[model samples]
Structures are given as structure tokens and as C-alpha cells.
Target chain A: MIKARITVTLKNGVLDPQGKAIEHALSGMGFDGVGQVRQGKVFDVELSESDKAKAEADLKAMCDRLLANTVIENYSVAIT
Target chain B: MKSAVVLLPGLNRDRDMIAALTKISGTPPLTVWQTDTEIPDVDLITIPGGFSFGDYLRCGAIAARMPVMRAVAEKAAKGVMVIGVCNGFQILVEAGLLPGALMRNTSLKFVCRQVKLQIANANTMFTRRYQPGQIIRSPVAHHDGNYFADAETLRRLEGEGQVVFRYAEGTNPNGSINDIAGIINGQGNVLGLMPHPENLIEAAHGGSDGRALFESALGIAA
Candidate 1:
């Protein structure tokens, strides 16, 4: 079995309203030292197949097919 | 005015969309699952609002790459009318069917309230039922409903009159660019918005302004 973790984030240069809002809120809360905030998602998957190469392929395919939006979001996978 | 409503695993508003469509068009729409390989032939396709895939990897990101979305995209290319509400709107943007992205609210909170929207472009399939510059009330409930695009893209959208709705005066609820609430694709066949029109279909459900959107699909002008 192979296990993998995936992280997804909005591409740079895209405005992150949530992060902006959090920055403002933090500032209002007196946490003035904070400079920037960005949010992301993480996914942990366990594959039953024993072939690491096949698992990586499947995982990448999943990311390309449905797990990530390459336009505004980027994704990376780490396998163990 | 037969329609098909796409249903993702975590979709919660599919029933509401079906009910609203039935009331306005008198024909219940077919529900297509995300994993389905084929999209049914219908006059319109609706991707209902919900936390699809638990909103795990960004709203609508996962659902955008679903098997059914590819078919939806193909149908959209053939000029099939498509409407995506809330999370579905995010999916459309993520899938490249529409421009811009729906970021989190500028307030960093899940905003749930009735917001006033001005019908910016009444020529599309969704807003044809509304009068030009008409003001209507609808509910917007989302955490990432802030819409963003590059300045050039925004200018083009404005020049092309692709913006369908904008937040009413003094109501930039999500801080979207120019207070945009909904937009249509360049072809004018596909639309994506953060508000939930289906939830406000009946008078008892706060208001009936949402009925016009469905009615427009049936060629009825409000």
C-alpha cells in the first residue's frame, strides 16, 4: 500500500479575499505583526495497490481529473 | 422546458432546484450524478449549490474535474444553456467555463442574508425574464463568494456586457469586483452566481423573485 498527501492552494497573483479579511480581522484584534494570510486544503489518501509507480500515476490522474483546478489552484503530492 | 440538474455527492440544493424548476416550468428536471459519464439531452443544465466533496480542496475544485463535468462542458460548447448556483458557480469558474474565481468573503465569515441585486444584463437565458436594471432580492449564503479577476478581464467583461447582476447600492456584501453577483460566459450560454435563487422560488420562502430565472428558461419574460 502507498500513502500520499496532497496540498492545494490558489495560484499566486489571484486575490484571496478570505486571507485579506483575516488580515484585517487580525489587525483589528491587535495582532498587527501579521503581514499576509493564505488558506489551503490538504488531503491524505491511502492506496491499496502495491505498485508505487501505479499509485503515483493514479494519484496524479486524480489530481488532474478532479482533485485540483489548475487554473486558479496548484496541487502537489508527496508519497510514502 | 425540460432541464437537467447535476448532483454531486455532497450537493444539498438539488431538491430545491428540482422543486423550483417544477413549479416554474411544470416539468421536473432529471438529476445527473457527478460520476455519470453521459449528460442527458435537455434544454438547460443546472449545477445546484452545495458543499460538494465537503468543500475539502477549495469550493467546487474537486467537483469541477468530475466525470460528468467534462460532458457538461461538451454540452456547453454545443450551446446548451447552463446555470451554476453557489458552489456550482465556483465549479464552473474552476472548470474554465467562466472567468474569475470565487474567493472567501471579504469579511471572512459565512454570509447568509437577503441581498439586493441589479439585473445588469437582461439578455442572457437566465436574466431575460427580468427587466433591464431591475432590482430583486435574493439570499446569498457562502463563505467564498468574493469574485475576482484581472483588471483587463474585468474591463472586457464590462465592455462585452457579460456581467448579469451586480450588488445593489450600498451592498457590496462580499467585496466582489464592481459588486458583481453573477456573470455569463463569452458565448452568453453559461452563467454562474453565488446567490441561491432556487431557495427563494416561492413567496413563502421569503420572496418569489427567483422564479423569474427559471421562467426565463421557459421563454417567459417576467
Candidate 2:
């Protein structure tokens, strides 16, 4: 089995309100020098396919079709 | 005019949409389920507001991939009138039936309240019953109602007059870009908005400001 991780994140220009809230909370708790914080989502999947390239492509398709909203976010896949 | 309401798991507002359509059109709309690969003939198709698929991953993300949405998209492509309210709007965006995306509210909160709406464009099939630039009241209840579109898409939407509604005055509940509350597709047949026009369709719901939308879509004048 091949295990992969998909990371989905808001694009740079897209506003990250939840991340901003977290940043604010960190500052309130005295965490200094925290310039910015952006939020993202991660998904882990295990594929029975023995071919690493095929598994990677399938994971990318999954991200494109379901794991991410490409209108405002970007995604990347890593196989472990 | 005949109508139908799309249903999916975790959606709670299908009945309200049905009730509104039934009372307004004098006929009940058929309730279509998620697994149905085909939708019967209908003039207007409405996707009601609610947390479909438990809002997993993102509001409407999972539900947008269901067979029913594909059917909705097919019908929409054929120039049928489609209206998606709140979570329905999210689904439409997720399904790529509409442009842009809805994000977490700028306030990072679930806001449930009444908001004043301005009919941004009354020339479309859904707003012809109202005078241009009319101000109306509608209720909103959602956590991720903030609307966002990239610069080019925003320009196109405005240039094409696809923007149908805006939060009137200071009632921008979720900090949507340009105070946009609702928009129609380029073809002007699919409308996806975050307000609950169904909830305020009559006096018993506090006002009838939202009835003209149904009237216009149904081709029935008030």
C-alpha cells in the first residue's frame, strides 16, 4: 500500500479569517513575533496500488475533484 | 410554472423551500433526492439552504459531487432556471455551476439574522417583478456566507450584470466582497444567493419583500 498526504491551502490573495483569528488568539496569549498564520487542510489516504506514479496521479485527481476547491485554494500531494 | 427542490443528506431546509414554492406557485414542487440520476421536468430548480453532508470538508463540498447535482448541472446547462440559497449557493459554487467561492465569514462566526437587500439588477428572470435598485428585507443564517471572487471574475460578473443582489446599506452580514449577497450565471438563468428569501415570503414571516423573486421566476405578477 502507498500512503499519501494531501495539503490544501487558501491561495495567497484569499482571505484567511480563521487563521487571522488564531493569530489574534496567539498574540493574546503572549506568543511574540508571530507575523502571520494561514490555515489549511490535510488528508491522508492509503492506496493499494503498487505503482507510486499511478497512486500519485490518482491522489492529484482526488484533490482536484474533491479534496480542494480550486477556485480559492491550492493543493499538493506527497507520497510517504 | 412548475418547480422542484433538490434534497441531500444533512439538509434541513428542503421542506421550507417546498412550502414557499407550493404557496407561491399554487403547486407543490417535487422533492428530488441525492441519488436520483434524473430530475423530472420543471421550470425552476431550487437547492435549499442547510448543512448538506454535515458540511464536511467544506459546506456543500461532498454534496456537490452527488448524482443529483450532476443532474442539476445538466438541466442548468440547458438554460433552466436554478436557484440555490445559502448552503445551496455553496453547493452551486462547489459544483462549478456558478463562479467564485464562499469563504468563512470574516467574523469567523455563524450569523443568523435579518438583513436588508438591494436588488442589484432587476432585469433578469428572477428579479423582473421588482423595480430596479429596490431595497428589500431577507433573512440570513450561515457560518460561511462571505462571498469572494478573483479580480477578473468579479469584473466579468459586474460587467455582465450577473450580480443580482447586494446587502443594502450596512447590512453586509458576512463581509462578502463588494457586499455581494447574490449573483446569477452569465446566461442569467442560475441564481445563487446566501439569503433566505423563502423564509420571508409573506407577512407571517414578518414581510413579503422576498415574494417578488418567486413571482418573477414563476412569471406571476403580484
Candidate 3:
């Protein structure tokens, strides 16, 4: 079995509304000096039976097929 | 009257959406799995709410890239009505079928409750049943329902009247700007909203305001 980790995030230049709201609220709470905040997602997958190379390929396929939106999101995978 | 609902692996409210469609359209809708490469022909395509792929790597992130979404996007471009609720809304946004993204609540807490929504734009196919400035109640359950957009994008949405539903006054549950509960694309074919209209199809569910959405779609086909 191979274990793989994936990360997904919104593409840069797209406004992150949630992040901005938090920034405002934090500033209101007197927490100034905060620079920037971008949010992303993490996924862990355990392949039933595959070598590292195959597992990485499968993970990338999953990202490309359904896990990440290539238009506005990017994904990366690490296998162990 | 053929309609279909896309079903992601972790979808939990598909049955509810199906039930709503059956009751409204007098037929059970077809279900298209995420792995399916083809989308069945239908007048409307609904992406039901659920933790698709366990909401991994972000809500709706995984499902947005699924094979079915590609088909959904293609169909949408041809002018099929696409409605996405909750996590489905996230998927639509992630798929770039709609502008903007749903982010975590500013409070960082999962919100689950009935929220009041104002019908901001009643001219769209998904909202023609509603009267302008009317208030309706729908249930919202999610951790990331905060809608985000750039200033220019927001202005454009407003100018084009693409903003469909806004959170009612004094009930901005998710802190969405202008209390936006739902929005439609410029073409007005695709609609995405955080609140679950599927959950409020019957009076027993505490309200039937959501029925209007289904009715509007049916009316369009009729």
C-alpha cells in the first residue's frame, strides 16, 4: 500500500472573501499587523496496492480528474 | 420532464434532492456519479449537498474536478439550468462555473440553522417564482459558506443583477457581504446558494419557500 497526501488551494488573484472577513474581524479585535491569509485544503489517501510511482500518478490523476480545479486551483501530491 | 442530480461519493442530501424533484416534477431524477464521464440529458442538473470526498482538501474542491463536473460545465455552457446547494455550491464555485469562492466562517465555526434570505434578484430562472425583495427561509449547514469575491467582481455582479438571494436583514448568519445567500452567473443559467433548498421542500420541514425554486425551473421548461 502507498500513502499519498494532497493539497488544494484557490488560484492567486482570486479574492478570498472568507479570508478577508476574518482579516477585518481580527483587525477589529485589535490584532493589527497581520499581513495576508490564504486558505487551502489537505487530503490523505491510502492506496490499496501500488508502488510509489503508480501511487503518485494515481494521486495526480485524481487531482486532475476531480480533486483540483486546474483553472482556479492547484494541487500537489506527495507519496510515501 | 427529465432532470438529473449529480451524486458525489460522500453526498448525503442526494435523496432529499431527489425526493424534492420527484414531488415537484412528478418523477424521480436520475443520479450521475462523480466518476461517470457522461452526463445524462436533462433540463436541469442539481449538485446535491454532502461532504464529497469527505470534504477533503477543502469543501467541494475534490468533487469540482470530478468527471461529472466537466460534463456539467459543458452542459451549463449550452444553457442547461444548474443548481448547486451548500457543498455543491462550493463545487460550482471551485469549478469556475460561478465567480467567487466559499471560505470558512470568520468565526471558524460550523453553522447549522434556518436562515432568512431576501430575494435579491427574482428575474432569474431559479428565482422567477419569488417576488422582488421577498423574504424566504432556508436551512444552511456548513463550515465554509462565506462567499468571497473581488471588488470589481462584486460590482459587476451587482450591476448585472446576478446576485439572487441575500441574507435577510439582521440575520447575516455567515457574514456574507450584502448577505448574499445565492447568486447566478451572468447568463443566468447556473445558480449556486449556500442554504439547502432541498431541505425545505415540504411544509413539515418548517417551510415550503424552497418549492418556488423548483417550480420556477419547471415553469421555464413548461
Candidate 4:
């Protein structure tokens, strides 16, 4: 059995109001030297396939199909 | 006119949509559940507003994968009319049936109120009853109605006249680019909008501005 991790985040130019709010809250709580905080989602998926190459491709397809909205978000998959 | 409304789990506005379509089309629209894989023969398919799947994993992410949506997308490709309102609009965007994404309102507040909309294009079947540039009032209630799109897509929409509705008179309730209130697919058969036209179709609701939308959609108006 193999496991994969996928991280989805808003693209560089996309506006992230929620992340901005979190950044403001952290600064209010006196966390200095923190320049920016962009929020993202992470998913840990278990694969039944043992072939690392096929599993990596499948995870990418999963991200492209549903795990991320390519218009505003980007995702990266890593097999562990 | 034959029509159907797709019902997803947590869809709170199905009844309102049914009532509106029934009153306008003179026929109660067929209600198709999300589990259904096929949609009955109908001229129009409406995906109504409400918090589908409790708005989890992005507003319409979960509901967009329902079997009924597959049928809806297929029918839309064949030129059947599809109207997606509020959360429905979000679903269409997430399902890749429409361009852009509905982000959280810039203010990060749930805005619920009537807003003036300008008819951007009245040549299509969905907006035929309204004069171009006419101002109409409709209620918008959503926290994630802010529309976001890349500059190229926005330009393409504007150039193609796919932008069907614009929030009027600089009354930009959300941070939607170009103050877009609604848009149509390239084929002009699918429409996704943030406002609740179903709620404003009766005089008892204080305005019939939304009635023309139904009338145009049902092909009963000049």
C-alpha cells in the first residue's frame, strides 16, 4: 500500500480574504516577523496500487478532476 | 413549457423554484433527485439556490459531482436551457459548466438584500424580454458570490457578449470583477447568476422584475 499527500492552494495572483483575515489575527496576537499567510488544503490519500509511477499519475488526475479548481487554485501531489 | 429542477441534498430553495416554474410555465417542473442518472425530456433544467451539502469543501464542490449534474451537463451541451441561481451558480462554476469561481464576498459577510442589475444583453432567449441596459431589481443572498476569473477569460466573456447581467450604477455588493451579476455560456443555453430571481417573480414580493426572466426562459414572452 502506498500513501499520497495533496496540497491545494490559491494561485499567486488569486485573492485570499480568509488567509488575510488569519494574518491580521496573528499580527493582532503579537506574532511579529510573519510577512504573509496563505491558506491551503491538504489531503492524505491511500492507494491500493503498489506501482509508484501509476499511483503518482492517478493522484494527479484526482487533483485535476476534483481536488482543485484549476481556475483559481493549484495542487501538488507527493507519494510517500 | 416542459422543465425540471434538480434537487440535491440540503437544497432549501427547491420549493421556491418549483413554485416559480409552475406559476410561469403552467406546468409543475419535474423534480429529479441527485442520485438519478438520467433527466426526463425537458426544455429547461434549473438548479436552484441553497446550501447544497451544507456548502462543504467550497460552496458547491460536493453537489457538483452528483449524478444529476452529469445529465444536466449533457443536456446543456445539446442546447437545453440551464439556469443556475445562487448556490446553483457556484455549482455550475465548480462543475466546469461556467467560467470563473465564486469567491467569498470581499467583506466576508453574508449579504442578503435587493440589488439593481443592468441587463447586459437581451438578445438571448434568457434575456429577450428585457431591453438592453434596462435596470432591474433582484435579491442576492450569499456569502460567496464574489466572482473571480483570469483577465483573459474576463476579456473573452466581454468580447463574446457572454456577460448577461451586470450590477448597475456602481452598486457593487460583492467584489465581483466588472460588477458581473450573471453570465451565460458560450452557446447561450446555460446561465449562472448570483441573484434569486425565483424570489422576486410575484407582485406580492414587491416587484416582478424577475418575472420577465422566467417569461423569457419559458418562451412565453415577446
Candidate whose TM-score is highest: 2
lDDT tens digits by residue: candidate 4, B25-143: 88999999999999999999999999999998889998999888999999999999999999999999999999999998988889999999999999888999999999999999999
State the iRMSD of every prediction, in order shown: 2.5, 0.5, 4.3, 0.8
Q: Considering summed lDDT, which 10 consecutive residues are worst modelled in model 1 chain B?
A: B213-222
* Top model number, lDDT: 2
Candidate 3 segments exceeding 4 Å error: A1-80, B220-222
Per-residue lDDT of candidate 1, residues B153-222 (tens digit):
8999999999998999987788788999999999999999999888888879978988898888767655
- In model 2, the runs with Cα more than 4 Å from the true position are none
Question: Which ranges of candidate 4 are over 4 A from the true structure?
Answer: none
Q: Between the candidate structures 1 and 3, which one is better when assessed by TM-score? A: 1
Q: Which residue pairs show backbone clashes in model 3?
A: A17-B148, A41-B57, A65-B65, A66-B65, A66-B66, B167-B179
How many backbone clashes can be found in candidate 2?
Answer: 0
TM-score of 1: 0.84
Classified by CAPRI criteria, candidate 2 counts as high
Candidate 4 TM-score, true structure as reference: 0.97
DockQ of each: 0.48, 0.92, 0.25, 0.75
Structural similarity to truth (TM-score) of each candidate: 0.84, 0.99, 0.78, 0.97
Fnat of every candidate, listed in order: 0.71, 0.88, 0.35, 0.59
Superposed on the true interface residues, model 4 gives a C-alpha RMSD in angstroms of 0.8
Those runs of model 1 whose alpha carbons end farther than 4 Å from true positions after fitting are A1-13, A17-34, A39-80
